[model samples]
Target: MLYYEDLTTGRRFQTASHTLSEDEIIAFASQFDPQPFHTDPQAAKTSVFDGLAASGWHTSSLTMRLITASELKDVANGLIGMGIRDMRWPRPTRAGDTLRAEVEVLGQKPSTSQPGFGVVQLRWTTLNQHDDIAMQLETSIWVARRPVTTTEPA
Candidate 1:
């Protein structure tokens, strides 16, 4: 299990690909975003995207899933997300687009007020099969520290 001490700045990780399905895209959008570009094909054709696309929130959710499923599955304490920043969807995510996630440890530091815990700043990026970035976000995570051990004097 990875702990705060186990992570290093500039370290990177990647996740498996997830192929988006048209049904899933529309279904997710209908529930959350409900925008024409995401929920209606014909309406999307007239929208700025010019075609059906997935909601930005949906893409962010998928990115989180991929990260947890692969990138941080082995961590000692999964994570407590402090907050997200600089979130952007540069390219629209469309049905049939295969997406994968990448994680980079941008910075880390021990918690000043809390013992046995630390904070890590991470940059997450989701890219398509063509290697174009679909979405990106920077977030801070609370990480646990490894337990201290002491041996009796012999």
Candidate 2:
């Protein structure tokens, strides 16, 4: 399990690909986002996207799923999301678009008020099959530090 001390600045981890199916896209949008561009294929043709596209929220949720399945699962304290910033969807995520994530550790600092805990900043970028960036965000998390161990007298 990775602890705060194990995370290095500029370290990157890649997650497995997730293929966005049309049904999945529509279903997610219908429940959470529910926009014409995301739910109704016929109506989406007249929207700015010009066709069916996944909602940004759906993309973000998928990213969370990928992170949990890939990176966060092994973390000792797991990950406590402090906040998120600079969220942007540069390109539309359309049906059949296979997506993968690259998560980079941007920085880390020990918590001033809490020992054995630290804060980490990470940049997550999701790319499509053609390598176009579909979504990007910066997030902060609180991670537990590795316990200090000392040899016992034998």
Candidate 3:
């Protein structure tokens, strides 16, 4: 499992791609966002997107899934979020778009209150197959520090 010491500034990684289908977008939006542009293809054609689009929340959720299920899966415990910052959806995520993520470790700092834990600042840039940035966010995650192990006297 990766610990706080395993991450450093400028460290980068990527996640596997996931293709978003029309059905998936509609289903996700219908349950959570419930907007015509997200739930109805025909109605979306007249909306600002001019086509069916996934909600920003859906894009964020998918990005989180990719991150947790891919490179960061080995993190100790899990990617426990402290908070999110500067989240933006630059472009609408269209149906049939294959999405991938670029992750970068911005910084890390030991927690003052928690001796064995630290906070990692990370940036997640979500992109579509066409290389368009669909969503981006900066977040801080709590990560465990490497445990100290003492060897017995031989």
Candidate 4:
């Protein structure tokens, strides 16, 4: 596992592509989001998106899956979601659209109160098949640092 000291500002990781299916979109939306654009093609055509669209939550979930399947899994220091900030959906993600997540390390700070933890800020941008950004957000997570051995501490 990568510790806080191993992370650097501006480091980036790309996740594997995930294709959205109509059934998956509707199923996810029906349970959580329940928006016209996400649930029905006909309703979506009149709603604004012009066709079936995936829910933002579904998109976020897919991104998380991609992150876990990538090299980030090894570096992750136990995710502690502090909540997202400035999240925006610039475009709609439709069925059959392949999506990928790119995460960048924006900043990191050693924990002042905790000896073996630190805070890391990350920016996640999701892009569709056409390489257009569909969603973007900033998040902060508390990560564990590599423990210091007795000899190393001295």
Candidate 5:
């Protein structure tokens, strides 16, 4: 299990490969994004993308899935995602493109007000099979830590 002590300024982890499928992309976009480039291939051909592509939200969600499957669950100390910063979708993620996620610990500080918890900042980068970065962001999360305990005199 991951504790606050395990988190260091340079700690990092990489996720396994995950390929995007046309059906899955369309299904996800149809319900949430519903954009022409994301849901319909023919329409996307005429659009700026020139082909079907995954929605930004869908890409983020897929990144989360890759994280979960990477066995980070044991180390995640009740992560409370504060929010994302400097988010950018640099390249279009088309169907059939395999993706992976890499997370690096940027900083961490024990919560002054809340005991047994620390705030951690991390930078996540998702890259496609061609090694091109598809999405990137920085996020903060609250992680549980081992609290100091005082022993009573025998």
Candidate 6:
């Protein structure tokens, strides 16, 4: 597993793509966020989005899934999230839109209270097939840190 130090600023990782279907969007929204724009494709035409759209939470969940299936999961040890900030869905995610994620390391700092771990700041940007941003968020994750080693004069 990669330690916290391995995650440096400007480091980026891309996740595999997952296509969202109309049926899937409806199903997910119906359970969590049952809004017309998300659950009813017909009614969505009249909604602000002008057509069917996936719930922002659904898009976030899908992004998390993609991350877990990528190298970030291995390095960060399954995305031990501490908290999130500035989560925004700039554009709607429509059915048939293939989604992928690009995760970048913004910064990292050793945990002051916990010596064996550290916190890494990451920016997660989910994009559609057309490269429109579906969702973006900054989150803090806990990553195991390699112990510092020092040598004494032999």
For residues 71-95, write the lDDT of model 2, one tens digit per residue.
Answer: 6678788878999999999989999
lDDT of each: 0.93, 0.93, 0.95, 0.87, 0.89, 0.93
Q: Could you give candidate 4's per-residue lDDT for residues 65-150 as a string of tens digits?
A: 88888877876566577889999889988899999999999999998999788888999999998999988999988888888776
**Higher-ranked by TM-score: 2 or 6:** 2
Which regions in candidate 3 have their CA more than 4 angstroms from the true location? none
TM for every model, in the order presented, reads: 0.97, 0.97, 0.97, 0.93, 0.92, 0.93
lDDT of 1 by residue, 84-150 (tens): 9999999999999999999999999999999899999999999999999999999999999999999
Model 1 off-target regions past 4 Å?
none
Candidate whose lDDT is highest: 3
Candidate 6 minimal-lDDT segment of 10 residues: 71-80
Deviation of model 2 at 7, angstroms = 0.8
lDDT of 5: 0.89
Question: In candidate 4, which residue ranges exceed 4 Å CA deviation?
Answer: 151-154
For every model shown, the clashing-pair count is: 0, 0, 0, 0, 0, 0
